[model samples]
Target: MDEVSYPSADVLKLTYVNVNPTNINGIERSGTLYSLIGDELKIANAVPGTRVFVYTVDGTLLTSSTTDTQGCSTLPIAGMSGSVYVVKTSSVTFKIRKL
Candidate 1:
């Protein structure tokens, strides 16, 4: 009998806002993801603390963090590549791909 092995990675939490020291929450819009390179994932937003999140197109949560006061957040993307990026919110979401 042969055993099947699947590659496993750690699951990370995704954040959409920075620590609301001023308020329990700030202006929220769910979140978005963008392709930084050819089939690559990176942070993309008009400003920091854009309440952005990075994740797998398959709806998998990767490294996540609330956008800094400037709406800047860090996403964990290693050994993963794709032309599509997924964005999600409490109600809606969309994808961003670069050609």
Candidate 2:
């Protein structure tokens, strides 16, 4: 691919997604993600070359882009707030709001 990629912005209108909690089965799953409302992006594990989609809180997919190896992204969410968003990729799968 002869495509050029840009760097991600420092500030972002961050939001979070509540993972469906469980007890007996535990909350561990592969390829799990915490996406933003109205957005199609997974908060963490957003590696470069990964195909992702951005959206709004109203369930509208706003944009599409890929991530960088640093787990940084090359796209921006329009009309976003300056909040901390996080995603857990350890034994427990959850989205932690990091500000």
Candidate 3:
């Protein structure tokens, strides 16, 4: 007797999805890019001198910082762990949670 292996049911149903397709001009586009490392929030690829604001989920303003000439800023988010926050920049707004 011979034994054959087959893909699992879940694997068989897996389909490729282009969540972020290329732009009309065939150039890939990106939105606001940032990252949270430790207790600091780092914003990159933004416009220079842009203001970045951090607020509590309840709309309470926590702190704000301005990007430098390189379009990057790092804001301290100490003491705000385990909670959701709202970060807003000149052109974009997003949510983040500190772990």
Estimate the lDDT of model 2.
0.46
RMSD of 1: 17.3
Instruction: Report backbone clashes per prediction.
Output: 10, 6, 0
Report the error of model 3 at residue 25, Å: 20
Instruction: Encode model 3's per-residue lDDT on 1-50: one tens digit a residue.
Output: 89956668635555558654644444233544699999899988888899
Name model 2 segments beyond 4 Å from true: 1-47, 69-71, 81-99
> Candidate 3: misplaced stretches above 4 Å?
1-32
Candidate 1 at residue 10, lDDT?
48
Q: Candidate 2 on 5-83: residue-level lDDT in tens?
A: 5455854555557655553555545443445544334445644455555444344555555556755453444355554
> Per-residue lDDT of 1-99 in model 1, one digit per residue for the tens?
999555555435445675666564533554544445544445545355455555557877654555565444555555555456566543335565545
The local distance difference test score of each candidate is 0.52, 0.46, 0.84
TM-score of each: 0.37, 0.31, 0.68
Off by over 4 Å in 1: 1-50, 89-92, 96-99
Choose 1 or 2, whichever is better by lDDT. 1
Estimate candidate 1's alpha-carbon lDDT, on a 0 to 1 scale.
0.52
